[model samples]
Target: MLLNLLLLQCRAGFESECAAEFMQHCVDVGQSGFPRFDAQSGFVLFELYGDALAVIQAVSFRSLIFTRQWCACLPPFEQLPADDRLSVLLPAMTELPVCAELLAEVPDTTAGRELLPFAGKLASAMAQRLRQQGVMLPRKARADWRMHLFVLSGRHLLLGVSPRRNGSTLEMGIRRLKFPGAAPSRSTLKLEEAWHWFVPRAEWDARLGGGKTAVDLGAAPGGWTWQLVRQGMFVSAVDNGPMAESLMETGQVTHHREDAFGFAPGKPVDWMVCDVADKPARVAELMLQWALQGWCQEMIFNLKLPMKKRYQAVQQCLEEIAEGLEAAGIRFQLSARHLYHDREEITCHLDLRVS
Candidate 1:
């Protein structure tokens, strides 16, 4: 069969949560599986007792919070002779569905980082072989499945398949970004990445235009505020601490020395961004209040998770926000992610679809 197992990738040390999510997905799809994973391994293998096409078709990648990337896989090709790795891998892929692209991926771990160079070489060689063998087709339409090779070592690897649009676009489900020197803090990257994931790139110019207004709660030394300034939007930076003078000098920011929970924008703003270090529920509640009261059109914020039941925490917070918004007759779009830049917290983006 083409697929009997699944390979899932996530941040290192988040394997248990990822596994729990995958297990629940299988149940949701009416399939059964026993998850195999080691905590902090950065990957999981859900060994389905039968085929996996049902779960693959039923679950959407964006709906999963902990899993970064996933593929329906056949059993691995282990213990291949070191010298001729491609010889074994090529024949295995021959019987699978049509594939136009091959992604060479590794776990997000110390050892996996070291194998990157080797994975690249193997992918290059395999791509040529696949083309020559007529297994790889020209992707005229964007509908083809992308083959994934989860390389654990030069000799041991698991092969899998994922639909192009249904899975993450980045290789191994990780986005690598260089921090800007002028940004006030590394936290700036969190909001920036959330923008890329939530706001479509083409719509950025329209939605994030200059002259638009924004509010940054808990803004201090202004990390999130810096991004708004760069967008050419005026910012009401709410916090008691001092802000970066360089940002203040730009005339784009008005620093408000006050508590975020107690602070209210004098008028509705274009965007609301928060990174307050509080309970996940509280942060989520603050966002709900802003949306319900018609204070901001869009928002991006973080939820600091607890030591245990992290998945449950994220779900409860998001659900509460959705319930509050819907009950109050507000229509909106909401999404969250355990972004590449986030640590012990998940980032969320909410847009009140008010004209």
Candidate 2:
């Protein structure tokens, strides 16, 4: 029997975890699929017997912890002439529905790094040719489809389409949020990526703008706290370690030398961010407590996973959090992802829905 395919990109070494999560999601939605993945390949393919669109619709990308980006798959082109690849690719382009943009990507692996320049050049050339041929829609056009070319090598690729409403907003599932040179640690990218993945940019002003207050648990060196302050939020930075002097100089942060778990805000704050190196369960409990007790209206935290049973561990932690929140009668929106910037950990965002 014929089966539809879905392509998912993820961090290398976690392909099994990603496949496990995808398979579980399919089972949860009553879709039957088997995932094909190899260790450290940085991508997974799911062959589904059911309607692919139905499965994609049932699973929101934001709720997926292991997947970085995904798309409905097309037949792989195994042989294209190196000198004139576009000639072969153009026919396929003509057959596809009009796409708003064309994105060329390579796997996130050592060997893939060598093809980055070629992939970018190819994408540029393809965009020009496809536009000239009217195969690609205009930039301002109201097109829903995005064309993606996953570069396997200079002469081969896996082509796919991702619908804008359900797929990643950025091309190739990569979030290119620039690193702030001023931020204290590289960990800043973790929170930045979480915001872009979980929160809509149009709603940033309303949800994370200035004059709001936040608490940064384990805020030493202030990576997460830097993000809060950058949003113009007054931050209570909780940690015993020294923070970045530049951040402290901003006068927007108040340091609390106390354990993040034991500390309580004088009143509810707009946001709470944590990057404490701790067990996933402990972090989940802290998140549930803050949300249930109304200590913070929103939170972004990290859950460091174990080397073995990573998927199971993540589910157990999330289930615990859900049960606690549900039992407390707290209305909340929770989303989790194993971000591109995260290693052995997943970022989670929780918003306490106000009645």
Candidate 3:
């Protein structure tokens, strides 16, 4: 049986855009299914057919899960028809029992930090419920479920609702989580929310082929470098400043002690990660060089943004990068977005085909 699919992002202030792009991607990726934008109902719905659940599960395992959220929408939630059908689809509610009851009990009322906890509660409850239902969800289902949290209150509060079958009864619940009160005041080089980075790092580690050479630009405090080292990649950390004491001791991480712009590996690397907090255009240029010059086969990086015209700036950056790659006759696939953990910035994933 096919089910409707929906995707949600945790970052407050980014639902409509996230929903639009995510649904479009789902339409393309979902061969057994297609999206139905139910703006009237304020959610995107998909008509999924054979193996629809499997495809969603697959995408969610890959790049579909961002930050603390899962972008793939869980159906029946968006355009649900009745409560009885809901009962048949939900899980046991063991992992987060509070979620199963509380989510359904509370209306969207709170904001900010309180809301995210609500999301966590819901995820826990949903996992419990799914287990009871015998749905046999993938391991990632718990972590990525938050992406379905919708932004209804000026994008400040997030809400997520899902149902999993629990034998003859459907256990359903709703979850809400709040975003941070303010953006970072300084570039401390230490992540306030390391979990956000960790999840994506795990995803990257899984996708990376069994190669080990990596370069981490702007490697101070070593947050990004730490992940690379832990993945068993030999990392040349390039930064004029010192790395974190812990990461420096890892031994797998090499301190290049230089500027990222000027430093280059002796030979091509399997991966390059840049979180330099530089202008988007400059970052895009750097990525172009790395791709065109055969410096790296894959890259995961971030581009800081100007507050005004965020979309315009990002759009232009993508366009220019596309032109650059085209002019150089390089074959690549690139994706950029405002990550759930990001504030005034977006992460970019670029892969270049190498023979």
Candidate 4:
């Protein structure tokens, strides 16, 4: 049976691109889904072919917004009441199963040009209508999550709600408003940005649940190590240097006071995480060796970039790493991005498996 599937893509510079890439990746994993076009919203729509909840969970966790683009699929459309259009589509849009009806539909209006009461009514009615259909997510049951709504041009209203940190309204406003004089802010930690960029917490937990272990190279201050330890996993933090007092206190982290290259785990670890201040090629080599030797099941590492040929460097590094891993007959999942947290660098995550 054809089913409606909505994909939530992230916005660039706001770490939304990562979400977008994941959505595209999901498209490639086509057994469970397929893509359709929603020219009305100016975003690609998807036709789900598997579990309704899986589609919702995947897109909800990926996109920063609670965006549900329109798509055409399945039967029983004629049976659905006109008011139930949005509700019928909600369950297929995310991992949640919600049945809602459109309370009202309002025409498009430009921002800063004075929105009519009907516009506000349209949004409010949509919310209330969903509540009536038991579509409202239980707030008391899930206190940690926050939701944001973005009304894009062309009457495209997308939602980006999550149960994570509530982004600052200033930051959100800056991104959405795009004020002319806004300078690119750099106060945000790059590694934190990379965490969200490379791996969402859900996927990270899934990897761990799948029995993934990890090695954190150059884990001095222990920022990255801290994250790993919190995940209830063992970490081999390699560095001749001392770890932060706080990380060492955790006891879950093992400090290998030696060159990361010279050291090897007694057995294969599930992951090898590197945040070293080394040349990109060298970092790539270390990652390749681990994959080629079957040292780890997956890897998330960083490559410090030079001033020149930034894109060229990334391409070259990817090629060399791919060739090396392929020569060793290792099949893997690999991704790289100019993470919001990275400066003059790009981070790579590789999931290596024997399949």
Which is the leading candidate under lDDT?
A: 1
Q: lDDT by residue for model 3 over 1-355, one digit each (tens)?
A: 2334433323444334445455445556654554554322323344455443454554432343222233233333333223332243343222222222222221222433344554555445545655466543544344323223343222222233332221001111212223322212233232323223333545654545254889988877676776666567888989887887767676778888887888879999888888887888888888877887889978878888776666567778877887889898888777764543466687777778532
- For candidate 2, the 10 contiguous residues with the lowest summed lDDT are 1-10
Give the per-residue lDDT digits (tens) of candidate 2, residues 137-193: 887787877778889897778777777777776655677778899999989999988
The predicted structure with the larger TM-score, 1 or 2, is 1
What is candidate 4's lDDT per residue for 1-355, written digit by digit as tens?
2234443322222222233443554565553454543323323334456643344444433322212122122232234334444565445334322322221211122331243353355456556655655666543444332333333322444333332332221212112222222111231244445555556667766765443467888877676776666666788889887777766776777788989877789898877788888889988888888788888877778888776665557667888898887776778777675543455577787777643
Could you tell me the lDDT of residue 148 within candidate 4? 34
Return the TM-score for each candidate structure.
Answer: 0.96, 0.93, 0.55, 0.50
Error of 1 at 199 (Å): 0.7
In model 1, the clashing pairs are none
Instruction: State the TM-score for model 1.
Output: 0.96
Candidate number with greatest TM-score: 1
